[model samples]
Target: MKINDYLSHEELKRLISALLVVLGFISIAAFFGFTVVPGLRYQAYTTGESQVQAVQGETGWLDPTEYPVMAKEVIPPIDPKTVMTPNPALMARGKALFAQNCATCHGPEGLGDGAAGKGLTPHPRNFTANAGWKNGTKLEDIYKTLDEGIKGSSMVSYNYLPKKDRMALAHVVQSLGAFDHGASDPKALANLEKLFASAGEVIPNRIPVSRAVTVLCREYAEAHPQPTATTLR
Candidate 1:
């Protein structure tokens, strides 16, 4: 028998029914695409971006410049020499700051065993050990690390911190440095002297963190202005 003759009437009927069902689905989809979807898209086009933003503004959309800046703290004067001094008061302040911020990653003792620090690749610094740290353990190096964290690491920039807070944290980190051997290398102390003697300006910590972020953004923009695209001939 020929292929068509071999098929039973029931089989042919079922096949034709399946084809009709598929065609009905396609027709429904095409109708929705041309009509229903267009209606939805039309609603979106009716509102301009500015108009939408205006509505959002009424609903409490605020500009960054308008955000409430926190009250500034009156930070005491500190020079580079004072920074390295083993002041009990400074160490106490640093400890508090570390507990608030650094302890999350660096642990309570600055040992890099914080619960949050766990699972980070290359592991966090063990302040007790001070191994595999990118920045040296000197006062200036710690200050630099606080200002700009180690690149390609879990460390983040703490420059947003008030200058005094950063300095205090640096002192805390420096204090954590415990040499495995007898004494620190002379070269390290020499490096600290070279950097700390004139460690630029020790900015007052009167400004709050919120304001500091804005200031840093402005400074960065000034330093690295984007180049305008040139038209190709």
Candidate 2:
């Protein structure tokens, strides 16, 4: 039989008409998917979004009573005596902060031998020497040094660091000293106590450093719309 004999005229016409109907249906589907429907082709995106919202809502993140921020300590005035004790946990927390913020000047071993301190006038305090530290070797004294920094020297105030970090950093430095300068004299202790008392306790709800920096940078950009880099080539 001839290949043209496979379908009569009516059958051929019906087959071509069926194919046209299928193509038309596919075109309509493509048009609706690419241009008309919002998320019909995206796995019901709104439903998935609602699920995400449901999970976040169930986590108490939006609730006022969760108080997750309270877990972090800010520059809350701390007890000097407590900081004097060798707390492994506090020391651990301070290690990284010291390396990042202090080691450049103070040295990793607190030896006053850091590369940055090479030309500094007064020189960084050599923790192992145990001599002539402006603030002395006592806990409160060191905390004061960290908080207020020394004058007429390269040492600048680290008061911007949180109180907890300051205390922890104090301990990290103290741990480097050759000898614990046995407790401060009674008169000195009394003076330190009074000073700390004046500062009062500041209960911080939150003090996230990253967030603080981002906010500060945002403020800075707003203040200086056209900042110039004179030092950079």
Find the 10 residues in a row with the least total lDDT in model 2: 41-50
Residue-level lDDT of model 2, residues 47-146, one tens digit each, is: 1201211111111111111111234232445675654455766677667656655666678888988776777788878877778989888777888897
Shift in Å, residue 139, candidate 2: 1.3
TM-score of each: 0.47, 0.49
Query: Candidate 2, 83: how far from true, in Å?
Result: 3.8
Model 2's TM-score against the true structure: 0.49
| lDDT tens per residue, model 1, 96-122 | 667655665567887878776676666
Number of the top-ranking candidate, with TM-score as the measure: 2
With candidate 1 superimposed using the best TM-score fit, by how many Å does residue 124's alpha carbon deviate from the native?
Answer: 1.5
lDDT of 2 at 136: 83
